[model samples]
Target: MFYDVRRIESYSLKISIENGRVEKVKFDESRGKAFRVLKNGFWGYFVGDVDDREGIYLAEKNAIGKGDVNVLNVSSGGKFTLKPKEDFRDVSVEEKVEFLRDVEKNLKGDKIVSTSVTYFENVRRFSYYDSNGNEVFYEIPRIGLIVSAVAKDRTLQFYSKRIMKPAGLEALKGAYDIANEVVDVVTKLVNANAPPSGDMNVVADSSLAGVFIHEAFGHAVEGDHVLQGASVLANKLGQKVADESVNIYDDPTLREFGFYPFDDEGVKAEKRTIVENGILKDFLHSRETALKFNSKAGNSRAEGLKFPIVRMSNTYLDRGQYKFDELLEIAKDGVYLVGSRGGETNPATGYFQFNAQYGYLIEGGELTEMIRDVSLSGYTLEILKNIKIGCELEFDPGFCGKVDQLVPVSDGSPHILIKALVGGS
Candidate 1:
C-alpha cells in the first residue's frame, strides 16, 4: 500500500431569484489539499489542509501517526473526465439569470403567492499524486436547479424540488416544469386538509422514493458508523434484511449527481450491490473499513478537505417489473406521497423520519383528496420488509449531509408500495 497527496480547486456560481426578481448572486472559489498515509492498521488517520505549498508539506509530515493504518492497493490512480453537454464556461451569467427569472414568472398562480428559484453551477478540478510515481488531473462539472413555491391563504403550504446532473446549460431545460410541479402541489395543499395518521400503505413518487432509499437505507450502510459500532448493520453481514423484491446499489461510475470517476482516496469507483433479493449482499466500505472486514469494495469519500470516510454515490434501488399503476392497484385505501423536503436517520438505531412535500389520499384504488403536513417515521428494516412492490425505476438528485458536511448524491426508484407506519409528526 502507498500514500497519495491530492489537491482540488473548485469554482462555483450561485444565483437566487425570488418573487420573479433576482435576489442574490455569488461566486466562490476554493482550493483543498489532502494527504493519504498508509502505515499502521485501519485505526491510524491524521489529516489537515492549508492553502500554501509550505503548509502542504507540513500537513504531509504531520499526517504520520501510530495505531492501525488501513492501506488499500488500488488497481490504478487518476481523475475521471467529465463531458458536459453544455459548457457553463461558454455561457454568460446573464443567460443563467434570465433562465431562472423565466421560471419564476411561470410559477405565478392563484394559490402560489410567492416563488423562489435557485441555480448553481460548479467546476471541480482534481490533481492527484501517489508514492508509486503516479499523477493525474481532471475536472468535473455539475449543475443544479431548485424551485420553491408557497401558497397564500389562511393556511400556508410550500413545495419544492431540486434537479442535479453533470450537464451544463442544457441541464436547466426541465427546470420550468419543476417550478410548475411545485406550484401544482402547493396549490393543491393550500386548500387540502390534514392527512389522517395511520399505518397505511403509501405510494411514494420517484423523488420521495429516492429519499426513502437515501435516508432509510443509505444512512444505515455507511461504513464509518459501522466502524464506530453505531450502525444497526455493524455485524449483520450475509443476513436477510429485506423483501425478496428489493435490491439497492451505490454506483459513482454512473454519470448522475453522485458520479465520480475516482473516489477521494484515489481509488476507482464502481457499482456495488448492498442488498439483493432481501439478502445483505454487502456493506459500503472505505479502504480502512474494507481491510477491517477483509473486503475489497471501495466506497470511501471525503467532503472537500476532510479525511476520507465511507459514503454513498448514486445510491438507489434497482427497478422492478411492476408498473406504477400496479402499486396504485394495491394501495387503494392508502396515500400517494410525493417529493421530499428533508429527513433524518439514526444509523445506530436504524430509525428514520422523512417529510413529504405533499400527498394525495387514495380511496378504493382511486385518487380522492389532497392532504398536507405528512411525515413518515419508522425503523429501516421494518420499512424495507414492508415494501410489497415497486414500479419501474426513476431517479432524483439531492445533497446528503453527514458529519456536518454536505455532498452531492442522487437516489430514486419507481412508486413503491410500503406498508409504512406513518404519522403527522
Candidate 2:
C-alpha cells in the first residue's frame, strides 16, 4: 500500500481592453491539498484542508477491495523553481492594466471597428510526498497576451494574434507587436477573397501545423485511449504510420508552457517518442497504464484534486530537412494556411477537421492573395502518410483540454505540405 499527498497554490490575473479602453480586470488565487492511497489494488482519493496525517489516514481507510496492480519500485525527490526576471507579483495591477491599454491604442486602422486586448498571467506552486519515500516541490509561472481586431468594409472581418509562454511578466513585452500584427491582419482580411473549395495541396505554417499535430494526432496516442480501444493506433505499434521523413515526440522537460520536472505521481518527467521515421513507437502513459502495457511511466497529470490521468506536455513533429521556401516550391499551387481557430477530431476514427483563422492562395510557387474562412479536413493517418516535413521547427504555446481537465501545453512543427480537403465560404 502507498499514500500520496499534494499541495497546490495558484494565482492569476486577467485584464481586458476593448476599443482603446480598459473593459475588465480580474484576479484569482487558490490553494488546496489532495490525498490518495493505493491499497488492495483499489485507489482512494480525497481532497481537504485538514492536517496531512489525518487526510492520509482517511484516504487509506477509503482504499478498499483488491485488483491486479503494480508500481515501479523507484524512489526520487527534488526541488525545482523558476524565478521570473520580472515577477508579475511585483507589478501592480494598475501598471498591468495601463500596459494593456497602450497595446490596444496601437490596434487602430481606418477600417477597424473594434479591438480587444487581453493580458493574463498565472503562477503555480506544487509540493508532493508519497509513502514510497518520494518528495518533490516546484513552481512555474506563465503569461499570455491576445489581441483581437475587427474591421468593417462591405462586410465585417476579424483576426486575432496570441503570444503565450512559460515565462514571467517579461512575456507581455511583445503585446504591442502582437497588437499591430492583428490590426494589419484584420485590415487585409476585410478585403480578402474567399478560398476555393476542393482537394488541393496545402502548406501549413508552424502554428497551424502545431495545432494539426496536437489535435489531429496527439490525442489519439494517449495510453488511456489505447487501453480503452478508443485510439486508431491501439494495435499498430512497430508498424509504419507516417512518411519516412516524419518523426513526433512528446517531451515534458522542454522549457515550454507544458514543462514539468515531475508528474503528479512523482515520476520523473522525460521525453516519449511516439513515432520514429514513420514507425509507431509508444503511447503517453500514467503509472497504471505503463504497468498495464509493460512500459515506462511519466505522463500522469490531474486538475487539482482530480484523479491523475495520462496527458501530453510539449508534443511536436520533429524538424525535417526541407526549408520553408523549399516546401512552398514543392507545393507550387496550394492554399497556405496560417494560424488555427480551433478544431475537432475523432481519435477512434483518425478523422480531423480544423479551421484556419486565415490563409493565402499559393500560385506559381508564391503567395498570391489572402483568403478567409478556410477549413482543412482529412483522415489523420492519411495526412501523416502524405506529409512533406520541413526544416525550422517552431513552437506555439496554449492549453489542451481532455476529460474536462485543461493543462498548459505547447505544440510545434516546421512547415508541412500535404494534400487534403479544403472548404471555403
- Each prediction's TM-score versus the true structure: 0.93, 0.97
* Top lDDT model: 2
Candidate 2, residues 369-398, lDDT tens digits: the string is: 999989999999999998998889989888
Error of 1 at 256 (Å): 1.2
Candidate 1 Cα lDDT to native: 0.79
The number of clashing residue pairs in each candidate reads: 4, 0
Residue ranges of candidate 2 with Cα displaced over 4 Å: 64-66
lDDT string for model 1 (1-425, tens) is 35667788999999999887788999999986776555543232334455545544554465565666656555666656787888988978998888788888878888777889998999888777766676677789999988898897757888787788977777778887877777777777888888878788888888888888887778778777778888887777889889888899888988789888877766777898899898987888887678777776568777777776788899888887677777788887889888887878788888888888778888888788988888987888888886865656778987777777778888967778887766674
Go through the candidates in order and give the C-alpha RMSD of each one to the true structure: 2.3, 1.4
Candidate 2 TM-score, true structure as reference: 0.97
The superposed Cα distance between candidate 2 and the true structure at residue 219, in angstroms, equals: 0.6
Which residue pairs does candidate 2 place in steric collision? none
